[model samples]
Target: MEQKIFDCAIIGGGLAGLTLAIQLADSGCTVILFEKESYPFHKVCGEYISMESYSFLERIGIPLSSMHIPMITEVLVSSVNGNSLTRKLDMGGFGIRRYTLDAAMAKLAVQKGVTLLEQTKVTDIKREGDLFQIKTAQGNFSSKLACGAFGKSSVLERPLGRLTAKSAGEKNYVGVKYHVKTDLPDNRIELHNFNDGYCGISKVDGDVYCLCYLTGSENLSRSGNSIKTMERNILMQNPFLQRYFTHSHFLYDEPLTISQVTFKRKSQVANGILILGDAAGSIAPLCGNGMSLAMHASFIAAPLILDFLKGRLTHQELCMIYEKQWKEHFSKRIKTGERIQHLFGKNILTNAAIGTLKLFPKLADALISMTHGKPF
Candidate 1:
């Protein structure tokens, strides 16, 4: 038997990895993508994407226009105290279930000749001379270049030296998600804040809605580690959330949950491997633009990876340029999201902020524009 090397090997099959794999395959590169989970799976996400990514997804073969997805052009924000406001959105987005979108992208990637390994876990990756030694559950493989799209938390973080002892114990955030049938407007997205957490609900494809939230881990501890208790005591305090909880029809037996989600800065280049998406730097979910950020990182990386494989750019140049570009585009956005998250989820401050923004609509527009970017 002969061992063959591919042009690129991507470790995760999220939006970043799938999009990058398809782009590289379209350019005639032998690309391999690994996804531990099978296709058409659910992720703990807001499932709302900014318009900045609409054209990009369309260009990449996602049939958003034909999917008849919900278009959101207005926002309804409520404080923990139930002080609420509704305002028009300047750069609205569309909603689609992650499984539907991800599965569509995976199909396109396969059609473009990308070898997608579903249910294949990558145990380790090492650099051997000029090639990357990729050891997975299936077998050992080699590639000219490797990518890390492993989302927010992964064992690979330690091996890549991206996690440290002190940071490991640092307080982490938890995310919860559900699909439901609600009477909320299909053209509007609502965000309701609670102590140490906030929830966002919007219309997705078909008649279902995506209801997702993020909170500090300590909140769960304070509630006896019970999601139902936390939701009833904390989240229901907001009249808006209470209405939805009492009236909506939940479609799942148990909500999808993920923990150890941190928004701290991450290395763009680690162990000589390129990092993209949430694994690189996750924006606060309040920003409602994380999907776009992840896809944009893939958009930024495809060409650079292509250049390196073609020998047009040296490895040092590729790493340096990618880091610079990644920071230039996303650093400020993440910082802004952090600041916004800080101001929300606190009763007094969030109520005052929402009250003020309601009186001054332009101020709300400016705040939104800060966390989002112009179309790529």
Candidate 2:
């Protein structure tokens, strides 16, 4: 029997990989996707996407009618000292959870004729002339071009060889989130400040509210077998948070956490593999724009790769183009996110900043724009 050769191989079936695969399939290109996990997996994310993603979703023939995600029109910033500011956000953003979004994209990819290999992990990858030989747990495959859409750190980064310095920030950071049934305002996304971190609350599909927060890992280490203990001890420092936690009933069994998410920069491409999504670069968790940026990058990368496959662009040219495009579109935004990460990590600074912003409405709007603008 003869093996099939794909024009492009996509390793990772997250939103970025699925988006690129759907676009290429519609453009009549052969793409093979390898996913390590099954569908509808939960990821530690803010779960908000800016309006920039709508155009790309439309192009892929996905009507978001089923996604009852709310539109957040305003941002309210509050300090622990009782000072607050509210701004009318310039661009509207969606608050859909990743579980719904990822499954929908996967279904659309299959409908668009993409060959998906779910739960098939890629073990090793090496170059064979101009092609990439990908060894997966299932078997082997070849493709002229390969994409690294794998989220965060993966086995793929090892062969690429230390692209970025490891983040040495306090490894005590942890993110816990839950889908809750609450009588919360659907149109507004709230960010409440706690002791060492903040919590973001928004309405998503089925009118269930998604609430997530990042806190110190040591806080949880002392808790005895309950997320509630961590929240009460570490997060209850703020009276506002204490009230919310005590008042709002949960919609799930308990909250989930992702420990020590590092945010040092990573390479866009290495050894003929193009990195996409969190694989290429990760914004700080508090930034809340990583998923939207990934979607926007996928929109741009698919067309660039299509041009390369049609012999209109060389591989070097494609790599250069992808890197240039991403940096041009996202460089400043990422820098801004990093800055915010540093500023908000300290309780005194965060409270002072929020208090200062509360006195100036226009300045508060400017700050909101810096964090959540719809550039890409």
Candidate 3:
């Protein structure tokens, strides 16, 4: 029998990959998706999504209006000493858990006729002539094109030679997330800074709040890898965080943690495979634009991909266009996020920056606007 070759094979089923798969499948292209974990799994993310992608999600079949998730329009940021600033967000956001969002996307992809492969891990990928060969635990698959949507850190990064010196040299950061029942306002998101880290609290679906934070790995080591100890000793130093931690009823028995979260630069195209989401590049979570950026990349890549598959554009043209568009849309936002991150996580500087922003509210709004993009 002749081997089956899909139009596109996506390595990860997160937001970017799943969104692209659904779009392609809806366009009547053959698409296959591989995900190591099953649906309804939790990930270490802030769970806040920019309103910019609201229409995009609805167009793709996620019924946002029916979900009744919290709509956040205000941002509250605080220094370690509890000095704070509040501003009305011009393009505010909504919060929804990864478990709910990803599972919905996965189901929609399948409904759109995408070949969904759960519990399948892609072991290797290589380009052979015009086709890309993918080896997975299930079996080998072939595709006219491949996309890498596996987020943040992956075992494939080393094999693909994506670990650049800048990424390797940076101080590693760890992220932790928990779902809790708290008194946080549904219309607001709060960011509290402590020593070497910051925490964000926002309401997601099911009337629960997602509390997530990122800290340098050294802080975790110093606390003997005890998340509780790190929170008690370091995070509680901030009065805002102290109040929440002490009062909230945590939903999870243990927090979900991910390590080696790098904000380093990455190439959009690596080894002839298109990379998406955090695989391409990650903005600092402090900006709260990562999810929107990921979905936007899919929105950008899907049309170019269709053009290539239909022969309107050559492979080289497709790659060139995607790379240029990705950079044009995201470079400034990523750079601005990096600069804003520097102002946080330090006692003196964070306090000073908050004080300055509080005095000049318009300046705070401008800085926040720089990290977000116009709705797509």
Candidate 4:
């Protein structure tokens, strides 16, 4: 049997991989994508994409009208103490469940002539002279360039090893998201404080609400398997959350949970393989724009990978370009997210800060700006 050859081989069929596959294919590159799971699958994510991704989505020919996701133009921040502030989001973003977004992007990839291998797991990749030989569970494939769009904790990150021996406080952080049927205003995104965790609620798709939360795993375990109980006891201690948890009803029977989410600054590429999306380095989820960041990184990398394939840039040059461009454009935002995470993770400090913000509403706008970034 003949081995399949492609200009590029993409690993992990998530947003980053599928988006880049479409970019490369539209650029006239023969790309093959290997995904471990079928599309329309659930993931632990915030599912919000900034206005920054709107142009990229359009560039790839995904019509905004075809997307059933909701648009949000406001951000609401509240404290455990009933102190709250709201900001009209300077730039609007869209919300779609990962299950639907991933499927839509994959369909776009197929339409653009990119080969998508569903349920395919890539086992290994080795650089063979000028090209890469990729080994998947199915068969051997060759490509001029390879991309790791695989999300956090995948086999791809193993070889680069740990960024530091210190855990950097990530071990305590866990994330969970739920898709629920509810009637909620589509214009706002709300962050509610629960004991050690924070929950974000917003509309995604036509009628489904995506409620995502991040917290300490130990706190969750101590609650005896009741998320609502944990929220009421630990999270709602904040007067603001107490009001919502007491007044509003959850639309889901039970929520989804993701344990032990860790974040580290990452090198954009290792062993000549380009890294894309969360596989590269994930900003703190509290930063609230990861989906857009992942898509933007893909937009940046597609051209660099293409240049290497075209022999316009050497392998060393390609890595240098990707790392340099990514850090220059994104390092500050990721760092800002880390700082905010530190502030919001503590109870007493968070309350005091929220109180201060309520006193001077401008502070809340500044914080919202920190999360939204420059107008794209």
Highest lDDT model number: 3
Q: Can you write out model 2's per-residue Cα lDDT over 1-113, one digit (the tens) per residue?
A: 88888998998998888888888889999999999988878776767676767666766776775556688787665555435566677885778878888888898888888
Clashes of each: 0, 1, 0, 6
Candidate 4, clashing residue pairs? 80-238, 80-239, 82-240, 194-235, 195-234, 195-235
Where does model 2 exceed 4 Å of error? 163-172, 222-226
With candidate 4 superimposed using the best TM-score fit, by how many Å does residue 187's alpha carbon deviate from the native?
Answer: 0.3
- Expressed as tens digits, the lDDT of each residue in 245-358 for candidate 3 is 999999989999998887888999988889999899989998998999999999999999999999999999999999999999999899998988887899999999999888
Candidate 3: which pairs clash? none
> In terms of lDDT, which candidate is stronger, 1 or 4?
1
Q: How close is candidate 4 to the true structure, as a TM-score?
A: 0.92
Where model 4 places Cα greater than 4 Å from the true spot, the runs are 160-170, 225-228, 239-253, 374-376
| Candidate 3, superposed: residue stretches over 4 Å from native | 165-169
Between the candidate structures 2 and 4, which one is better when assessed by TM-score? 2
Q: What lDDT score is found at residue 155 in candidate 2?
A: 79
C-alpha TM-scores of all predictions: 0.98, 0.93, 0.98, 0.92
- Weakest 10 consecutive residues, lDDT, candidate 3? 162-171
lDDT at residue 226 of model 4 (Cα atoms): 73
Instruction: Give lDDT per model, in order.
Output: 0.91, 0.78, 0.93, 0.79
Per-residue lDDT of model 4, residues 214-303, tens digit only: 998888788886777777688778675565556655665666777767776777887888888888888878668887778888988988
Model 3 TM-score (2 dp): 0.98
